[model samples]
Target: MEVRLTREQVLALAPDAASSKAGAGLATDGKWGLLGADAEALWGECQGSGSKPYQTQVDLAGLVSRCSCPSRKFPCKHGLALLLLYAAGNPRCVPGTRPAWVDEWMQGRRDRAARKEAAAEAAANAPPPDPQVQAAAAAKREASRWSKMEAGAGELQRWIADQFRQGLANLGNGFEQDAQRMSARMVDAQAPGLAALLDHAVSGGGRDLPSLARLGERLGLLQLLTQAVPRVESFSAARQADLRAALGWPVDRETVLREGEALQDAWFVQGQQLIEHPGNLTERRVWLHGVASGRAALLQDYSHGGRGWDQQWRTGYSHSGTVHFHAGTVPLRAVASEVQGGTASAVPADDTFDVAAQACADNPWLPQVPMRLSAVTVAHDGQRCWLQHGEGTLALQLAPMPGWSLMAFAGGHPLCLMGEWDGQVLHPLSAWNAQGEQWERSSA
Candidate 1:
């Protein structure tokens, strides 16, 4: 098969850092036997401590893997190493017939996919439910959920007040446990969004001033949300939708496609980032800029148990797509229902700090806003890296290596930098030089 994936892309599929390191180490020819590939898949036998060599195969189309290793992690280290070797164009992985085991596995995967599609088609063609009955049931369920959320919000409000009255410094050794318990309570109350906020407050910072300030800010936002719960009906539809979303009520994909705001534009893929969460879950965020509308959009995808994302978006490319935006005061998150082929495009880097500030002003709860700074140079002052745009400078929240890479790429010249700004720090994702050469943040 024509392996189009870069080494970085292949490593991005690793479940964790340890897997990525181990896979890279095993990519050398010394670790494997009978490595082979064809148009459909790649298969190899990795010699482990066991009597028999472990069999690993990867489906190129879906980027899914099957391995004989006794590991719960999907696409275990052996599978990752096999793909890594293929991606590196190692001589050992030559064109060959598919093994019987690999053939059976690939066929089973295709069969299951076909069955799922057929089932979905059947459901879509099935007789419609009674509209009034469906509507009533939905309304009842919503009302019950809202009632539970309101109670949760009230309890949260009280908890916040108690924290302030007792003073944050006095929370003592049980603060972490208390926060965990409160977060669990929010989950039981069917307010996962609130629970997530508490979790962030617990994990986001230490007992420092800045961290405490952020914690206070989050608590204040929660206070406002709790106060708004009772008066939600008085707000506009969009505002109510925002409040509901903040309370952890998600709009289904079908509902978003049918009722949410739709915009058709050639979206420039600015950058993407992957965040690893608890429970072996990874969240990928892809930021896009509309060429015609001059608007920003975010596409989020989640992978559980290392199955991997459904799509891969490359930087420095533009795709013609229709994005259906989720309901919010500031519509940024979207679902791309239709995306055509991608073509190389220049980075649309015209935004400044003011844009991010205004976005935050409009929606205080927004965690991050995309920014593209024009004519910016990376500056390192012995301690941290900063982006120097004209006379203004923004602190960069980047690791040392990537920061050095950005500085080196600039070579003492100005470049267009695209990144996400979270009020205090700018996280650079991709950069383009004056000649339009692109530099993406390393997945490693």
Candidate 2:
């Protein structure tokens, strides 16, 4: 089916204001040659400063942009210009047979999809394995893991009780070192999640009683996990999964796909942000707000060495897909089971921050929650920003670069915006004007 994108949607893909302006400048027929659009793709050649005109194309089905230009910014000016021209229904973008370059890209995507389907079919039709043998092997592994965890928990319990007896004032600076050593023991026992909590506690170095109290709470949670691990089989499936995750067991993607609940909806790609973690790993969290279900979902992707993740979904885009949710009490996190089609469309957003906060109460363990506010003006005290809507205000806690970008887009005017709210602060990710003008900054 043929797909058309709006001007605001095209601008939302721009990395910055300069790129938006430059892309708009190149949208005219005078700057482009050999533009064409088929049911599934858009292609064009943009005359640029270089000797060779840049070839640009958009895979409408996947909302993926490609350009034969050196610019690293996603959906570079040439690609956006091609899209804008197509969105304007320019005569040059009339339906035609795709060129070699376009057909090659399309074929690659189709081949990958076909291979995935074949693999899934093969697995489904394969004979069942010997259940008895599998169960015996799994039981043996579980027993060994339990033994190590038991020992580690015993050690941690003794250390925690000893700290209380010694008293915080008497422990001196060495107390922090003791915590780190215990944290290392937990890591050795394969409880990296507990290790992380201990690391976070000691990182503050008892600067305040409130901080110490927070540490106590984390320790309490760890102790609870230790208790739960021994009785894991007795707990419900969802609770067991939650306990395992809290104790550092990794989520099994295959298991989730095989047994997890699935929901299909028009998911609005609200916002995304990157988080730095220990061990040279970086995580990108993307939020999707469901249009029909009125539920939120989180897509977490990780990369090593801080290289950064590619733009999978742009802000202000809508993706119709099937999502598989992990086993949990509040299933806000999910994996995209199938991405059918992605388009730029306006989706309804909750206007009040309170409503968003209430929704997060279902999954209180989440560090951040997705929120959307309508007609909110950006207020600056020359230091930071506050999203003011009527009588309420939510502070924006963003890094220098994104803070400036948000300010430039807001310009003291009210906007329909989407962002991440971390209880205390809001990080604005994208904004749209009344006239459908859009500005998005997905990084940081």
Give the top-scoring candidate (TM-score): 1
Clashing pairs in 1: none
User: What is the TM-score of candidate 1?
Assistant: 0.82
Candidate 2: list runs displaced more than 4 Å. 1-128, 150-154, 157-171, 205-234, 276-281, 304-311, 352-363, 375-395, 415-417, 422-424, 433-435, 439-444
Compared with the true structure, all predictions reach lDDT values of 0.82, 0.74
The TM-score between candidate 2 and the true structure equals 0.67
The ten-residue window of minimal lDDT in model 2 covers 305-314
lDDT string for model 1 (1-444, tens) is 456688887876664445667888888888887799887789999899998998899888888887888664456789889988898888767787888998898898889899999999999999999999999999999899989999998999899899888877666778888989999999999999889878876786478777777788777777887888889989998788778877788778888889889999999889887777888787888999999999899998787765545554667778898999998888988899788867668777576567778888887767788888888888899999998876488999988888888888889998988889877789998888988877767432
316: Cα error in model 2, Å? 0.4
